[model samples]
Target: MDATPSAHAAALWVGLHLILLLVLSVLVVRQRRKHQVVLGDADIPELTQAVRAFGNATEYVPAGLVAVAVLAVAGAQPIVVHAVGLVLFAGRVAHAIGLSRSGGSSILRSAGATATWVAYILGAVALLFYAIP
Candidate 1:
């Protein structure tokens, strides 16, 4: 089976990722504006730390998504694929927001992180099942 995505679906996926990246960039820029710090400035430790957390989230979210897309293209149930993608997207957005906020904590961040991991695991399990049968 061809793994190439339909034009509309591919556009939607690309747009979704672009939106995520753009939102992160906007958050960084807004914080910099509010604090008047260059990207390398060490004075704004909290902002710097928040940016680092965002980076960490970015790393995991996309990797999980790649697994999702691969499994989806490999014939995981379409409904499952959509549900997983939606959950992962929601988690990434929520995690990013909580991390950027001053009151963020392990609990708040963990909610989204856990959701993302579940999505990844679901995709992996589906892939494994497909491979075995």
Candidate 2:
């Protein structure tokens, strides 16, 4: 079986992001244990924030991973793959930090969202160019 650098690059970013997701999971667990709330967030601010952060990542990361993989497989340049990966990484981290700090809107969260969106858009457009022939 052979795999291109494109898949490898996507895997690299996916692995990194998955690691961060594990960290986010840990944060939620810690919050849960600290608050003694076994199920749900229990309406605690910290726990709620932690849960939402983790939940948000769950909602976004999987789709983003697929989009990135498709884009890479569809022949995006190596540099483009890496840049998208980096942006996704930074965006997820920043958004997590911002959410942990406050549930409300914040600069880091906003910037992180924009970066994530930009990464996806770039990947999609680049994939179109490569795929449409």
Candidate 3:
């Protein structure tokens, strides 16, 4: 474990994102608790769909970051990795905020989704270039 600020920041980035995921989980649970959507009820459709969509959004952040941390550990360019990580973190937070609302332009959500996918691709490229050789 290298004793560098970037290394610590990378870990922090992961940890904070995990916290966001948990927060989203809580939100879903709270909604369920309040609405008490019973099994197979007609009115449950929207709530269930929202839950699924939230889950779909939540699914990307962690899976996208696994290779990133490995690349960071393998000594890939810390600045690029850190920048991507921080950007992804910020993007996810903004995305969750916007999605929780009933209506808004989807620019934030699109930006966040794009950031997540781009970070994953960039991390994969970094791993291939740095970790393979």
Candidate 4:
């Protein structure tokens, strides 16, 4: 099977996601330095939130990106791959922003969580479609 298109598309979205993760990591590091937090959260609220925001991305983004890459390689439509990836990316950004601003709940946080879940489900379904035969 010709995987050139899929590879290209997967590279684009995965690279973008890496950049986003780097940005999120920087936020956590900056917050840590600002709060003089050398260890886990240092019991500081903002620092804690920053750490969790970064941590949350680590937990979700890798799996989501893998699913996306698999879908792409398995010949899923490029548009669908991109749409799901975009949702995941946007969700991570929104979630980070919302959590950074306030440790508690917010519309951005809720929307971000929802988007991430939708992306995951969509990616899984796409993979299943390709895997079925």
Candidate 5:
């Protein structure tokens, strides 16, 4: 089925997120192999952060994609869709870098968290304003 142009915008975001997920997965795998941890993080902070970064992406990326779908279905502009995608991608990357550095506190972590939350809120509001009758 050929997607409409707006759907293509959504697809672009989806594809980008998928690539991000794959990268995060590789990071986790490398962390595990390096540390030789079988199941869990084995109390290693870097491994813990790697796992959590990937885990966190699993939690948020799908929801963001859903929002993108809604926006496309609702006839949102492609630029809006791209904006959402860019923010989500950048947020995850930032968060991963920050978390990979430390399990606790970091400016990148905080900024990434903020960007991620903003993307979520934007998506939600876009649904409300664009889709809801």
Candidate 6:
């Protein structure tokens, strides 16, 4: 295995997610301004939803990105890395859209959450496989 990490695939995915997160942040900011919410959702439901959607992405995306990057650096197969990345990105977008619209019982939200978990689990397994001697 090459000691130097080849992170081209990982970098692409990370860059895409970063942009997604930034767009989510902008959405939240726009909601806040539109609703005149100064801080902490301001008891506005839409604002609250937007904040949580953004927060959820922040909570989930970094760890996913790290896992993908580590796998890339450790020389995991490119297909596996891309698969995980695509699933994670789709999940985040779905979750954001679902949660932004309705607070409860959304197919998109459920699928998104499931996909995110699957990506994380698969990433961990891949990492463990590479790390084990």
Per-candidate TM-scores read 0.76, 0.93, 0.76, 0.94, 0.92, 0.93
Q: Model 2 residue 120 lDDT? A: 82
Residue 129 local lDDT, model 6: 91
lDDT of each: 0.66, 0.86, 0.68, 0.88, 0.87, 0.89
**Which runs of model 4 end up more than 4 angstroms from their true locations?**
1-3
C-alpha lDDT (0 to 100) for residue 63 of candidate 6: 98
- Clash totals for all models, in order? 0, 0, 0, 0, 0, 0
Tens-digit per-residue lDDT, 4-102, candidate 1: 443334335546756886778676677777888776635676667557556866687677667666655666666656666667777777777667664
- The numbered model that scores best in TM-score is 4
Better of 3 and 4 by lDDT: 4
Residue pairs with clashing backbones, model 6: none
Would you list the clashing residue pairs of candidate 5?
none
How far does residue 76 in candidate 2 sit from its true spot (Å)? 2.2
* Candidate 1 runs further than 4 Å off: 1-14, 103-107
Off by over 4 Å in 6: 1-6
Q: Identify the superior model by TM-score, candidate 2 or candidate 3.
A: 2
Off by over 4 Å in 5: none
Per-residue lDDT tens digits for candidate 2, residues 1-133, read 9887888898899999999899999999999999999999988999999998898888878877887787777877777788878887888888999999999999999988888888788767677777887
All models, RMSD in angstroms = 3.2, 1.3, 3.1, 1.6, 1.4, 2.3
Give the range of the ten consecutive residues with the poorest summed lDDT in model 6. Answer: 1-10
Regarding TM-score, does 1 or 4 come out ahead?
Answer: 4
Pick by TM-score: 5 or 6, better one:
6
Top-lDDT structure, candidate number: 6
- Segments in model 3 whose C-alpha atoms lie over 4 Å from true places: 1-6, 38-50, 103-105
